[model samples]
Target: RDRGGRGDRGDRGGHRGGGHAALLPPGRTPGGTQHAAKEGRASLRVSGVHGPEAGLNGIYLPTDVESHDFSCWHQNDSFYKVWLCRGPRAFWIFQPASQRGTAQGFMISKERHLERPQDATTWRLWRDGGWKVFSTIHVREASPKDVDSDAARGRAPPKKPP
Candidate 1:
């Protein structure tokens, strides 16, 4: 997640203008153009779940975005969902815990705002006996309307027991 601070300045693919770009070694520009990553949005979908958060299996959009760093996603209520980060090996999803309704769901990126996994990958959440586990993750481009719809749904009042 783009923390919006200097925390992600070290390894983020792109370089921010003004002070940071001047520090780079000569003759080597950043991977992409400046502010290029802030163009679009991404969607992350979790499937084949076998844990507490199984019912939360759906498309997640980026909740927080940064101009130079990748976006990050978490549930609106809690923080148990997976975080998308630019790991040594492309994109990786890290699930901190297994608490249900821990947080909201959203998609994020590194280097590129619209970046998605090359293919559906499996990930394991082994914390506390695997409280949140999934077999497949799907990433894709998300439109602004899509995001607004999901946000509306999230804001809708909960229904009472029938």
Candidate 2:
């Protein structure tokens, strides 16, 4: 069953939201705790201890920043549960759960979700062609050096980095 309180139908129903409720718990992350809004669009701030797989984790934002899809967004302008599967190399398995009937085969599936990237820094999020990367930024207090550098370059410092 999905977080929506229904059995998985495999793509024969309407688009659903709140898919990440099962994967992510409220106010929990690797470095600290932060809460995602329950009813509005928000960013999923991913953080983890930098290790041999340092590049494996980072911030994942929806293709539409304003999109209510707080989970993974598909190129077709829908949200999906992007499963990162381990193989010789890591890959994605996104079989969107339907709400009405069984339709599990990928051939009949309409949504083309995020495909694997050549490297950890990018992902193919669009069909026509556009690759996006997980944000390497973690929210923290900026030092005076950062402000000075921005001013020297004639660029205004961001009120907040997203």
Candidate 3:
């Protein structure tokens, strides 16, 4: 289970407040959320259990395993913040602990105002006795003018032009 900030009160576009408080890096908060006064300080606790169907412990559908609560904080320095839970466990499908590796049933913060394309990030859960980061895909925002130009051009630009 998980608990953190509340969802945005208005139609301000997917912004939330008073929920899972992740640690901030130095002078930055992720997605403009309030940062903690100290570094590496988690404003909220994240914990959950993974079932056998999660493919953990070599079991196709093992019983639910309880997970320890992890301290999270907000950091604006990076486009996103990541937290990994060591050991074979499952996190809450909703709220703060949004799965992002190879597992199913994960949720992202409503306050995360960035618009992401499909497959931009893949959530995975491994059972090698600890939480491991399988992969991460970062999506950068395109400027309004760039988007307009791309639309006019009728095609996306190459990853890296020669």
Candidate 4:
């Protein structure tokens, strides 16, 4: 689903203080591992990784959790939009286009609760038959240099030219 409002900035759910969890940088495993198997285009099992520290803004989903319904504040509109989705295992920060190299999808899950927080935007996911937390990311504010460097390269890129 396109969250952005008719612009590239909103295309990937990018807006000031918009609570959209950022997808894990390509090639980096969710649990912070650096192995080849976890670095490829494999559908990651939620149980494979450890949970994040408490209080960090991120998405969490129980493995057996089949659906998720949640809401977050809209930066531009200053209102909350109810987000809903149903699937085998919930994914917090999902990339819409597998190979488009842009965050252009919606964050979906089952059984969303609570109202939008004015100061902080947060959400949770259920995976591995348990609940987990994930934080939304604001990509538009990212620096051009950083964005270029952070693009998802299926395999590690060669060293930059001097």
Name the candidate that leads on TM-score.
1
TM-score of each: 0.38, 0.20, 0.17, 0.22
lDDT of each: 0.34, 0.25, 0.25, 0.25
Q: By TM-score, is 1 or 2 better?
A: 1
Per-residue lDDT of model 1, residues 1-162, tens digit only: 422122123422211112222233321112211222334555655444545545444455444322124344333223334434433323333322221111112221222223444243434333332123333533444455655665666633112100
Model 3's lDDT to the true fold?
Answer: 0.25
Off by over 4 Å in 2: 1-39, 64-162
lDDT of 2 by residue, 10-61 (tens): 2221123333322333333222233342354222332332433233232332
Summed over model 2, clashes come to 2
lDDT of 3 by residue, 27-111 (tens): 2222222222334222222222244322111101101112232222221111122322211122222222232121222233222
> Which candidate tops lDDT?
1
RMSD of 3: 17.9
Question: Model 2 residue 157 lDDT?
Answer: 25
Number of clashing pairs, model 3? 32
